[model samples]
Every structure is written in structure tokens, then in C-alpha cells.
Target: METEELQAALESAGLSQYQSDAYVAVLELGKASAVEIADACSVPQARIYDVLRDLETDGYIETYEQDSLHARANDPGDVLANIRGQAATLAAAAEEIEERWERPPVDDHMVSIVNRFETVLDRARTLVAEAENEVQIALSPAEFEELRPALAAAHDNDAVVKVSIHAADESDLPDDDALSGTVTQMRHRTLPSPFLALVDRTQACFAPQAHSVNQYGVLVDDYSLTYVFHWFFLTSLWEVWDVIVSERSEDPPILYTNIRQCVRDIEPLLADGATIEVSVRGYETGTGVRQNVSGTITEATYAGVSTASGEHIPLAQLAGQVSLHLADGDEDWTIGGWGAFVEDVEATRITVESIQYE
Candidate 1:
């Protein structure tokens, strides 16, 4: 008996369902007529001749004429070799399709338009399912439902998923317990009309339908393009307002997306006149000058040596870089600057460590 996985692979390798069935059936029978092959594979006798013809043309089988038509499976080794060659060619063609069809320039952001809503939905699901590290998405309820099954599969595979729902209230979140086994971090805040999904911070999908009745989308593969879309969504996420679930049970690590959030985390310390000993370890974004500062925070916003005007300082002055440090046994943790914070977040270079607090 062929394993289910092997059968799936056979179908995926470009064999039609009936073709695969006929090939396997003939192999099991050693030699059989079209009628016999059909019976063995449960295919209609009318379809067997065409199935056998395709299999023969594809080098999966041989046909002989006797008193009745007879068919036999090809040598397993030869069949496998042909399949391998076909697979290699198919893979090359797939790559060539992207190259020729996309023709994306390396210098600028490239966007591929997806016309069909179904195609957009499939691509979005694939982005989530194939994520290695994280999937950050701002989803319409429709988009969310469309991708939930794949998201569940990704969850089962240990990929992290964070979803921001375009719902007015937490109660408006998807109540169906389809994802009973998976832990899906859902935050309910009204998002924009267009649905957006960012995967591994590398791939982005913008499926929107506002001005027109037809749903359309853009698939982004370029890093700058991906970041721009993500930043836009994140910026818009907090636009107008954000609703946080109070008394929530889980406390996920704070992933600072912007300067404000980073500053907000340390505001209490600065307000209470507590001098927080912070260590920053990143270079200035503009000059690339290595900045290493270890000292008290005069203001929560600026991660700098001088007590300069944190809000008023120009972006070029600080170069946008900082490292956050916590003392051993110190519950307080602050390690990001606004301009620097945004830069670090974009580059995934934020470093947090412990420093000796006198």
C-alpha cells in the first residue's frame, strides 16, 4: 500500500489523481488490461485508456498488444529517474517564471499585483504557514478566517503568530473555537480597510477592497517594501486609538515597534525621580559612530549622555541608536531611544543586558 504522504507527493509531482491511481494499480497488477487496471484502481473503464496513454507518454508504464491490450509498469528505477528530471525542470521553470514575470530591480522596492481575491487569500495563507520565526498581521475578520487554518498549522509547527483584528471590540473577535488546540494571540483594534500580513519581517501582503467592489492585493518581497508596509500598518494601528485587553492573563515580552512605546515603558522611573542606570550599545544611525553609554536617564525618551532636550533634538544629533540594560535582580528594564528605537527595531539589533547598578 502506498503511504498517504507518497500519494500526495505523486499528485504534487504533476500526476493527475487518476493517473497516479492507474500507475500504481498497474504496478501492483504486474500486467493488466485497461479494464482490469480500472477495476483495480477504482477508475472508470472509459477513463483507463487515456490514463494509460498519459502514463505511457510520461514513461511510467509500457503497453503491449496481444489478444487483448496489456499494460505493465515501467522499471521503478527508470520511473524515478524520469520523475527526478521532471522535478528539476519544473523547479527551474518555477524560478524562471518568477524571474521573467517579476523582473524586480534590486535597487528599489518591487510589488507584485494579485488580481483575484482567491489568489490573494491563498498567498496570504502560504505566508503565514511558511513563517519560520514570526507572522505579524493586521487582518480583516474575513481575511482572518480565511487564513486561520493555515495559521493553526503554523502554530502547531511552533511558529509565532500575532494578529491584530479589525474589530471594534474584543467581543467582536472571532468567537468560533476552531483554533481550540492552538494559542493565537489576538488583539482587537480596528485596523484599516486593507488587510495586511507581514511574515518573518521579510514578506508582506496588502489585500484591500475599499474603492472598488473587486478585492485586489499587492505581494511584497523586497525588504524595504516589506518594512514600509509593516511600519505603515503599525503606525496606523495606533492611529486614532488602540484598545488593550485589560486583566488579560498572558504577558508577552514587549516588542518595541516605535519610540513612544519604548519611552512609555521607562516613564514611571523617570517620573518618580528614579535615576535608571541604562547601558546602550549600538552605533549612531547617521554617522555610524559607535555609541556606548552607561548612566542615569534624565528623561525617558532620549538615550544619550547629555541631559539634552529629548523631544527637541534633531534626528541627526543622536544618530538613532541605544542599548537597554537591566541590573541584576532589577525588575525595571529600559533599553531604546525614539529615533534609535525605531532604527533598532527595524534592524532587529536591540540588545538587552544586565549592568552593575550602584
Candidate 2:
């Protein structure tokens, strides 16, 4: 496989563009010199060595030292086996991670009951560092001061920051005048607990009511419960829910946790004749195997779905088996779930990136 075919095949096996080029070049030339390989691959000769080094590291190429270094493609069969082994290793790790964290694949989660104050602060800082998009926190002014570095890093990472000080005035901060400006928005309010932090509106850590002031905190990344935390603090207790400070020009995809709810949500727009893009990831109940798919939603009903490949399965069959990512732009409504509900699913999620949703 040379040119497009070779490139596609190498890419499918997880080779970088340059690595694919170099590997194919080496294989094609058969025992070629570095310059010859570079020339064949159309890669800069000076840069070829680095690419070759990476390829060798990945077991895609074998290098020999002589008057000048020479290289050859690793045996195709051996490389294939290596790919299989690497893939299996990755899958096993993913399974272990999934076993520990089955909700939305969030990286760092602190769901522990620690009596020590240091443990609480450490976990809160960890959550801040792991935040990828937005950080919505409800804490005292003092607590905010303590987590300043973590919050600053989150802000610098371009995450939208929302801070609600529970019973503390923003103006009365003993320090952090400069850091205060970095907060996208600040509000003052009262809360039931001493400390509460929510990141990306998807995960939260709240100090449960206890005899001690900040006795222990419970962290949760589960979608089922985070909404309550947001509503309780951002809406009920604190009162200001305006995240008017826009993080992105476009809103993030609305994540629907349940299959039936998603079906109901999309029911009204049936007349729009929208070609939906749906991505699904879930477990095949029968095989106990996980699957993932993201593509156009061709057929759907209250019970199950047909997506990406025009195949449909019943809901009870995949009960609690799927998660959906949906966006209805001007022309189409895109939905995505893991393999449990869709077909031809891949590890790398595909989306309706072509359309812009307002």
C-alpha cells in the first residue's frame, strides 16, 4: 500500500503522517540510506532522522549502524502483532478505567470522605487542574484564596470561571486583588455547606454537613446528581446563574444521559426533516462487550435507534446501555452514543464538525 492506500493503512494502524511516510519509504526502498528514505518519503532529510527515531521507538522500523545509519521496515506480520498487542493493552487499561469510572470518562475525580482539611484542599486543587472547559465554584472567600493557583491555571487554560462566594464579600478579600480580576464573574451568596466546587457543570465536590466545619467532602462526576448541585447552588441558594461570560462562541453539546429522554427531546423537531448525527457508546448486553458509534441518525423511535450505519436495536435491549450527545444546528440534529446503541463505532469519536450550531 503506497500513496493513499499505504498512507491510509499506516494511519489506521496508528502511525503519524511522517512516520507513515518514512515507514513506507523504508519498506519501498528496501535497506535504504537515510537520505534515500527521506527523498522517497518527501520528508526533509534533516528531519527524517527524528521521524525514523520515533518509528523505531514504535517498533515500525529497524535501524542498523554502519558507515552511515541504514534502516528497514519491521516485518509486516510482526508489526501487525505489535499493533494487536498494543491495542489489547490499551483496551485493558480502558476497561480498568471504565470499571473505576463509568461516567463520561472524566480524568480526575475525588469521591472520597476525608476528615483532614489538607485532603479536601488537595482534591479541590486536583479538580481545578483537571478542568477542561469551565469551572463553577461556590466557596467562601477564604477558600477561594487558598485555591488561587489552581483557579488561575484553569482560567489561563481558557476555562470560563464562575465564583460564588458563600457569605463573603469579594471586596473584602485580604489579598488577591490581581487574581480577582482573572475570575470571569464573581457573586456573593450563602450556602448550606462550607465548601462546594463544580467544574464543567458535570462534576461537583461538596462538603457534607458534619459536626466539624469542613469535615469531609464528597466528589461526584455522575451526570445524574450534578444537575441538583448546580440547581441548588447556582439557582436556589446563590441566585445568580448568568454565565454570560461566554467560554466559546458556540455552546457545548447538550449531553442527555437517558435514551428515552433523548428520544423525547428530539420528538418535537420531527417535522424539521433534520438529518441527525448521533454518536453512541454502550455495552452490548449479550456479549458484555462495549461498542461506540458516531454518525448520522437515520432511524429512531421511542425504544431504540438506527444511526451511522442505518441499523436499529430495541431500547430495553440496551437499557442503561447508551449515552447520547445531541446538537440541533440550523439544518441538522446530531446525536452520538457509544457502541452499545450504534454501529461501526470507533475509539476516536466522530462528530458533525462540518455544521455550526447556534
Candidate 3:
């Protein structure tokens, strides 16, 4: 390297500019009077003596009574090692900057454990904003408001957004008008609960309840693991809660938060020979390939329901298994919910886009 560049590198290794310059000069001269170092580098004659003394004290050079007090570069083993270590550190930092500049690829492990709840929440914001089919979240009222903008953006993109606000009382509930256009359905639970956000049925961000003994978070990018979190969201955080805001339509083109709700509403319609033309957004069960399918609902099947007696069935009753037979053009597909192990497709959002009387 050039002398100026080498001197700058030495300065970066914790040397003052004058000390670096004087040391480089002594190393070049082998043994030089203080006047020689000051002449070779930018160190002024007035400061050359003090600079050489400081360099010798730090072992970068040794001063001796040679003719008129000369400084010779020391063995330089330690100084070279220190400079090399600093260069390595700088190189590693540059690589890190480049790596972090781009979006990181999802790791092969699918699940990442982290220390802070905010990490999961921040990732949830990005996932929610990009959600294609569905977004499920359970958080405190304040967190709901914090994520509201991203939720609203997802909702605007026609994604199904269901949120459960936990640890909230009547006073913590957001005004209904404030919730409009931001969520498909919102429920409020007065008890504390863990934070969770599941997006598109494939990714989940989860954290333990704040009062838990050990606080941490789990971020999942795998379909199966995310399905587990999805059910936790349904059973533990959402199903039992009372609706605070529901943007569902009671008329045609009805929107269902999930496949179970859609099946419950459409079972009677199919029984009455009403052809349900629906559009569904979800992924294939076996391949995890996502698609939007528009077809006729030929049949609806689920356990724990009595269509013969017209008895009212709660959604939890049919949670064990629910599937719909969809006839699209010349093909037929069986659609299931959240985690469909046996069916062809796992429907995340089902809409009664249009219906016809057969």
C-alpha cells in the first residue's frame, strides 16, 4: 500500500494521525533522528519529539541515544497483529451491511426463537401488509392500534383480516367507526393472552403472555407449524370471545372469516338446491401452492352437525373436520380449512361471490 494509505490504516488501528505518520516514517528509515521522521511525515518539528516518545511508550517504536536521540521501529509483531485484527473486523462489518441490505432468505429451520416480543410484532407488520389471503392476530388493544395501518392495508387488498384484542375491557375497545375498513372481524377478550399473528396460513409470529415466567417469541415460516398457531388463535384467543366489530355482509356476496363459518352459512342453501358460486383464496394441501378458485359449491361436509333437524350448531362443534366439494368447470376439488391434511386445498378465505337458485 501507499505510505499515505498505510498511515491512515494505522490511524484507524487506534493511533493518532501524527503517531501513525511518525511510526511509518521510522519503520521506513530503520533508525532515524526525530528530525528525519518529522521531515519524512506531516508531524511538525515542534511535536516530533513528543510524538516519538508516545510511539515508543506504546511499543510501536523505540527511542535511543544515537547521535542526537533517534527512534527505530520496534519488532512490529504486536502492532502488525493489532492492525490486521482491526482490518478483519472492518471487513466483517462490511459483509454484514451487505447481507442486511437485502431481504434475508427464510432459513431452512422454518421456526426461529427470539428473545423480544417486539421482534415478532415488527415482522408481523410486514407479513400483515403483504398478506394475500388471510391475517389472524391476537394482541393487546394498544398493539391493535399500532398495527392498524398495516391491517387496513391488508384489508384494502381484499385479504381476510381477523383480530382479537385481549387484556382489554369495554373502555379499551376501539370505536366501531375506527375499525371499519381495517378488519373483517374483531373480537375483544377481557383476559390476558399471548400475542400472535398468522398470515396467509403459512407464516406465524407468536410471543408468550407478558406475565409468563420466561418471555420470548416464536416466528414460524412453515405451513404445518403455522397451522398449529392458527388453531391456538382460534381456540384460545378468538372463538369464545364476543364480537366487537364485524364487517361481514348479511346479504349476497357474503364474506366468511373462515371456511367453517362459510360452511355453516351455506349448508342450508346447498340443502335447498341453491347453487353457491364462490371464490376461494387458499393453498393446496399437499403442495402448498396458492391459488384463487371460482367454482360452484356442489356439497358441504362436516361432522357434529344435524342438517335434517335444522338444529343450530356452534362453529366449535364443526371444528373437528370441515370440507367443501367445489366443481370448477370440468374439475372437482375438495377444500378444507387452515391445515388440510387430507383434502386437496386449504381454503383461507371463502366468499359467496354469487349464488343461483337451482
Candidate 4:
């Protein structure tokens, strides 16, 4: 590259014109006095001293006063590295300021436009995967047609897809050809809402009424706001028209069983010293009863229960007081007619032996 181009590049990288010229001159002359540098670089003698001071401060050049002003350019590698480092620092500081100002509010609703039909489909697939329990979708025939592939993808991943459409037929939608069987588990429903879909009780998106027969539409992903929309649709819209709906299971029994197992695993981790307030519903009474108690290794106390019968009792004393019986197979095992137990010293499972009403 020419000297002028190199000078321009250096200046663009944040070196002053004089500093760039002086450094180029130094590179050519090997080493030079301030007056010689100024003459070679076409910089004014008065400004040469200021330019040298800046170069020295930036570690781009070394200066020595040996009876006269003496200056030499540092390594070219070192100069470029320092300039790059300074630029990065400025960029990082700007990013932090931008992030603070651009932070999103928790309650704010956000709308984004997806011009491509495929992008909208991908987003819907992502929403289905993130859904915890339920999913609901309302789409026009054209948009629903585009979502067939996305629906199959969701089904392949074991997601329960519940779709509502305005005019699409159930037989027309895509079927799972890989298994040589149709996607029979999809829930199909009919909705009058002029939009595409709602998923996970959180996100909702709408197809443009203009492109309800062809192109893509505006997609909204805010959950809290969509709940309000759902409420309005259920109350105001559902009262007027006859809505057709269908539902199918993904893995109903496995889902419920997994939830029960999770509760069982977490129960033991609720240690002896832990206090929990539980509202339990009885099978026979069919009413939820609230109970709060603190349990320990040696004793359990029900301070929240004001009745005299609800007083605390030691682990060993619980056998007689609660009509406890030990299981024959396990020595440390016991059963109690009431809900109270010892920790590690003895484990007890409670059953509904009887309920006495005062």
C-alpha cells in the first residue's frame, strides 16, 4: 500500500493526522528529531511537539531528550495492538449503556412481524416445545396449511398439538407418512377469531386479514397479554357462535405418572426441620382441609391447630396416641392412622384409618 493509504488507515483507526504522518515519517527515516520529523511529514514545527506527546502517551513512540528533541516509532505490531485495544474498550462501554436503556419491561406487550411463512412456522414450533401443559391455536386456512409441517414436527417431538381452524378440513392436513399412519392424535377445533394461533396459554399471533389466503402476518409472543385476549374471546365471542372442537392425547398416562413420581421424590427432601402448610382434600369429605405443622426428628408440633388434640408429641409416644402399627417386614417401618411421623429413626406412612368429628 502507498504511504498516503497507510496514513489514512491509521487515521481511521483513531490516530490523528499529524500522529499518522509522523509515525510514517519515523518508519521511513529510522529515527529523527522533532524538527526533522515535522519537515519530512509536512506537519507544522509547533504542532510536532503536541503530536509527539500524544504518540508517547499511547505507547506508539518512545521519546528521549539527549541535548536535543529525539523521537522514534515503537514496534508497528505494538502500535496497532494498542489502537485495537482502545477501540474495543470504547465499544464495550457503548454496549453496556445501550443494554441499560433498551431493557424490556415485564408487563409490556411485544409484536413482531415475520415476512417469511417459514419463520413464522419455526416460531410456532418453538412455542410448542416450551409449553408446559396446554396449547391452543386459531388459524386461517392458508396459514393453517403452512403450519402442517410444523405440526408434524411438534408431534414427532411428543408434543400435544391442539389446532383450531376457520375453514381447513381435518383430512387435508399433513399426516405422518414415516410411520405409514396418519397423525391421528392431533386435536382439531373451529374458531372465529381472525388470527393464526395461541400457544402454551402465553403467546398469540395473527394472520393479516389481507393475506388470509396467501402471505404471512404479524406474530405476537406476549403471554400475559394473550390471557386477557383469551378471556375476551371466551366471554364475548363464544356466546354467539357454535364452535367445533376436537382433542387428542400425546402421552396422558405417562405425563400424570411422571408428575406423581416427581412429587414422591421431592417429599423425602422436605427434611424433618422443614415446616410446611398443606391444604389436603379428602376422598370422602370432598372438601379441602388446611393444616400447618412443623416436624422434627424427635417430635412434631401443630401450633397452627388450636385444639387440645392437636398438641405436639414425641416419635415414640405417637405409637400409642395415634394407634400406630409397625409393618412386619421392616423393623424401622410404622403406620399411623393420623398424619404424624418420626424422621430417620422411624419412617411412617399414614392412612385413613378413621376420622373423629367433634
Candidate 5:
């Protein structure tokens, strides 16, 4: 490159403005005093000494003490090499930070675990072993069998392992002997809903099928979506399965309880102008109803009313609904025929009588 171009490139590489000017001044003068260098480079005379010292330290210029001061340019090759080396070091540090930030959030997760059954098993084992209070598994019998060892390990660690199986028969579970005396403590149930597993109300995994030979699933760590999953699992699926396991059959109470809890847990999370999904098994002629309603809230003088295009009203209209069913607790409560509404100082809470999702 030309001399000016080379100097500009060096400056761009990381040279301070004063340093670049001083170095270029030394190159032009061959040798010069601090005052002469500063005058030649248009740098402040008072800062000339420090700038020279910095350039010399950086190996861009050589300085000598005389009557005043004398300096000369270092080899341009060495100066450029030093600048490039500094640039490379900065780039490497930036790349290292980027790599760290891009890494998966899971602790101790290995990239090699992808599509590797054995690695997945190891990951599952590690996750299960880390469970503290509760471990829930929704899996087919075959899938459950594959993770039986890890489940047993969780049980050994004093974790409550609640297993929801999709087996055609409960007898498909390993005989009581396989549980090593912990079978009695294990909460086993059959779920009609599709696959879902939760651990300590934090981590969850779900497959697409209720009963499937393949155990392909995605494991999610503590996240916003996990909160929604926990609500759905505990209120709807788990409650219904609990009833099924307890009563050994799907009863009307189980359906009602699950539906009530589902509505209770899901409503608050809905955005003000968003549609809420209600999944129910029995609605039209006792067949079932699964529907989505776009709801909007309108604040009024005395109260607010939420409206939707469908028969079900929006959550905002909850306060004025004549026949809503309100849950009993330490709060302002009202029940109407269609659903329930609870009014607090901040907002009105509404619960659906029955909900089903399409």
C-alpha cells in the first residue's frame, strides 16, 4: 500500500489517532525532537512525550533522549504485523464470547446428543437424577421401560415419580417386583391425552402421540412455555388421570373437575385482546366441544364487559355476566349461568363452564 494508505490502514487496525500521527511524523522526518514531531504531526506539544513513549512501547517507533528528544519509525512490516496481531486477538475474544452466548442453555448438554439414542438416554438419566421433589412421566409402556432405570434412580433419590402410561392395559407395566418395593409409592395412571412429562414443575418433555412405539420427544427446561404446560398438565391431564387411576374409570366428576381446573388455570395467561382455547370432551349433546373465541375487553363506567363473536363472552365482560360461576376464595366472587367471574381491584377473572379446543 502507499505510505498514507498504509498509515490509515494501521490506524484502522487499532492505532490511536495521536499515535498514528506521531508515527507518521517520525517516518517523514527520519528523526525529530518531541516538539518537532508534535509540530510535524499537529499533536499537542505537551502530549508528545507520552505519545512517543506509547508508540515506542508498541514497537511502532524508536525514541532516543538527546538535547530534547529524537525518534525514528520502526520497520513498517513490524508495525503492521503488530497491528494485525492486536486485531486478531480482539476478534478472537469477540468470537469466544459469541460462541458462549450461542451455546444451548441446558447445563452439561452435549451437541452429540442429537439423533443419538444412547446419548439421549444419558441425557435423560442426567436430568432424572437431578430431580428433587417430583418427577412425572407421560410415556408408552415401551418408552417407560426404556427409562425405567432412570425412573428408579429418581425414586431412590426420594423423588415422587408419577407415571402416566398409554398402555392398552395397566398390566403392561413391569410387575411390582421390577419396582423394587417402590411400586406402591409410585403414582401410575393411564392418560387419554397425548404425551407429556414434567419434572419438579420445571422441566417438561412431550411427544405427539399418547401411545406410540417411537419415543421421539423434545425436552424443555424451565421457560415461560413450561409454566403453561405445568398448568395444563396439573389442572387438566393430571387431574383427569388422577380420577381415572383412583376410580379405575373415567367418571363425570373427573371430567368436570378437570374442565373447571383447566379454565381456572388458563384464563389469566390470555392476552387482553387474544383468543382463548377451551378443550372439553363433552359439550354438544354430550359429545364434546373444542372451540376458540377471539375476546376483547371494554372498560365501562360501572363495570367492564368482554365480548366475543361466539356465545362465550370475553374475559372483560365477565363482571356483568348474569349467570357466571365464580370460585370461592378470599376475593370478590360472582357466578353466572354461562361461566364464573371474580372481580379484584385490578381486573375481573373469568372461568368457562366448559371448554374444548379444535
Candidate 6:
């Protein structure tokens, strides 16, 4: 390196401007009196001795008397070692910054917008691993495979994992055994779709599809914000899809996250005068205080016209007041799903505790 560059580097290495210049001068001269170093560099003659003394004390140079005090450059073994170590640390830090730029670590923010979808997925993995009640996910087939391990972990924890796998063709579909132990329900979306994962009604990770003009990711850990994404997942990514695999129990004590699905499953049984008893977990509509209601479902009401197939309620039918009428002794209550403002209870979870055949 040039002398000026070397002096600048020495200053960056923790040497004062005077010390770096005086050291460089002494190194070039091999040996020099204090006055000679002051004349050879920018350091004033008055401060040259103090500068040389400091440089010597720091092991950058050695000074001794040979007729008069003279300065000489030291071996620089320790100095070079320290500078190399600093360089290596800087290089490693630069690489770490690049890696984070590509795929950032999951942040602590309640809501964060990120540049890469991988970041959203990584956060989803974390949330899924910690899931307690339910997990809803929609992704491409390949992406589903990528998250299978986390889904399996959640499933093992008894978290209801409902997955929507979207692909352009049937060739990308997962086999029946693929979701056997990893998912409670798996559906197929016959087209490319955006990525979404909602965990426990409190966290959500969302990313637009590749075909969109812009690509970005949103991570949410707030209940109010996640609720919005939860509905988006249900209406757009989930409800319309065709079920490919389902592990729903045929007996009582079934857990339902979606009230519409609970109604669809038990509607016929109720029509046949089968007494369906359930435990509903949700908040009171007007007060927003959490409460539980357990009793027999006496009736169900919806707005849209019923489909001729009668297999499931149409999504349009559920848009209006789709509520379950529960009778607990003489007292009765109306339970609504998700966002329930007009009903007595906004149900978040419903467990069918027992069923009685009349």
C-alpha cells in the first residue's frame, strides 16, 4: 500500500494521527532521531517525542538512546495480528448482513412487512411449532413439503392443522399418505395461490403469489390484525377448495374451529332429531368478555338459499347470520362464528361433547 494509505490504516487501527504519521516515518527511515521524524511527517517537533513514546508503548515501534534518542519500527507481529483479526471480523459481519438481507430472522414486531417470502415462512414455522389450538395454512405443493415437518409437530401437539395445497395440475398433488399424520384436513386448490398461515388466531404470515406485480411478505402477531388475515384465509384460500384428505372423527367429541363447518357436519344429525351437545369457547358479543356455553344445539339458521346437493352450506349462505341456537336447560343462547357482533356469543371453538340418537 502507498504510504498515505498505510498511515490512514494505522490511524484506523487505533493510532492517533500524530502516532500513525510518526510511526510511518520511522518505518521508512529505518532509524530516526525525534527531530528527524517530526521533520519527515506532519507531527510538530514539540510533540514528536511524546508521539514516539506512545507508539513505542503501544509496541508499534521501539525508541532508545544511541548518542541521542532515536525511534525505530518494531517487528509489528502483534499489531499485524490484531489488524488481521479486525479484518476477518468485518468480513464475517458483511457476509452476515447479506444473508439477513436475503432472508431476515424472525423479528419481534407485532406486525412487520418483509421483502422475502422465506422470512414469512420461517416465522410461520416458529408460530406453528408453538401452536396450541389451530393452524390454517395455504401454500403451493412444494412449499407444503417444505413445511411438513412443522405441520407434523403441530399435529402431534393436537393442534388442528388445516392445509390448502394449490397447484396448476394434479401432478403436484400429495399422496393420501403424505398428509396422514401431519394434517387434520388437506384440500386442493386447482390454481396457483398466495401463501398464508394463521396460527392460534393470533399470528399470521402472508405473501402474495409470484405472478403478482410486486412480491412482499407480511408477518403479524397481533390478534386484531391476525383476525383480518384469518377471515381472508377462510374465504379466499380455504372454503372454496376441494377436500383431498380429512381425518375428522365420526364420533362425538369432535373439535371444530370454523362454526360453519361445525354446522355443516351436524346439520343433518340435528334434522333427524339427534340431540347434538357441544361446548362452545368464545367471547360474549356485546361485552367482549370470554365465556363458555355448553348445551344441546336446538337449531341452526342461515341466510342464503340451500344448495340442492345438501352436502355443505354454500359460502354465500354463511356470509349472513349463520348461528347455532343452543339450549342449556331453560336458558338459551345464540352462538355465531368468527366475527359475531349481533349474536350472543362469538364462537372461536366448538367441541361436540356427545350425540344422542332419538
| Best prediction by TM-score | 6
After superposition, the stretches of candidate 6 with alpha carbons farther than 4 Å from their true spots are 1-9, 16-50, 71-112, 169-181, 220-228, 286-289, 305-311
Candidate 6 has an lDDT of 0.86
Off by over 4 Å in 2: 1-110, 168-170, 173-176, 190-193, 208-214, 237-331, 334-358
Rate residue 252 of model 3 by lDDT: 72
Candidate 4 Cα lDDT to native: 0.50
- Model 3: colliding residue pairs: none
Error of 2 at 200 (Å): 3.2
lDDT for each residue of candidate 6 in 214-287, tens digit (9 for 90 to 100): 99998887778877887788888888878878888878789898888888888767766788899999999899
Model 1 deviation from native, Cα RMSD in Å = 11.9
Model 4 Cα lDDT, one tens digit per residue, 122-206? 6665665455434455555566556566555555554445554454455654334421221223333344445545554557655
Comparing 4 with 6 on lDDT, the higher-scoring candidate is 6
C-alpha lDDT of residue 156 in model 5: 78
Task: Write down the TM-score of every candidate.
Answer: 0.47, 0.38, 0.69, 0.42, 0.34, 0.77
What is candidate 3's lDDT per residue for 277-331, written digit by digit as tens?
9888777877878877889988888877555544445766786888889999989
Worst 10 residues of 6 by lDDT: 102-111
Candidate 1 worst ten-residue window by lDDT: 346-355
Candidate 5 TM-score over all chains jointly = 0.34
Q: For model 1, how does the per-residue alpha-carbon lDDT over 268-290 read when each residue is reduced to its tens digit?
A: 44544554544454455556576
TM-score of 4: 0.42
Q: Rank the candidates by TM-score, best first.
A: 6, 3, 1, 4, 2, 5
How much is the lDDT of residue 107 in candidate 6?
48
Clashes of 3: 0
